[model samples]
Target: MPTLTRLLSIIGLIVTGAVLSMYLLVSYVEPEPREIIVEIQKEGFE
Candidate 1:
């Protein structure tokens, strides 16, 4: 049916846009480096 084909096309377009945006973000962004420290209680090992 025409309706089913239209719905599939819309969904495909949305998915394509999402993937393109994510690829751009991944390819162009840089993350800052930071040190993290955590303290654990010794009693938890028992």
Candidate 2:
């Protein structure tokens, strides 16, 4: 029972490390905002 617990703990640690690394890598990505221009023609188009 003790051995199984230890093995599970090790796996959990590895998964946690992978998740942390992925989060850190994605934090560097910068998303640019886009500008949308709407043109309004004659008042009859309403």
Candidate 3:
């Protein structure tokens, strides 16, 4: 199985590349800050 080994190696390389790209993207990207608003009502208060 030389062919099998080669196939496995290719698959591993693809998986490694995908993981590296995802890590890079996550490390470099930033998320925006947002605020949350909530309103509450009581029995006697509007």
- Output the number of the TM-score-best candidate: 3
Q: Each model's TM-score?
A: 0.61, 0.59, 0.63
Residue 40, candidate 1: alpha-carbon lDDT: 31
- Candidate 1 lDDT tens digits, 1-42: 999999999999999999998766655663321211112333
Per-residue error (Å), model 1, residue 46: 22
lDDT of 1 at 37: 12
Q: Which ranking of candidates, highest TM-score first?
A: 3, 1, 2
In candidate 3, which residue pairs clash?
none
Flag regions of model 3 displaced more than 4 Å: 31-46
Please identify which of the two predictions, 1 or 2, would achieve the higher TM-score against the true structure.
1
For model 3, the local distance difference test gives: 0.65
RMSD of 3: 11.5
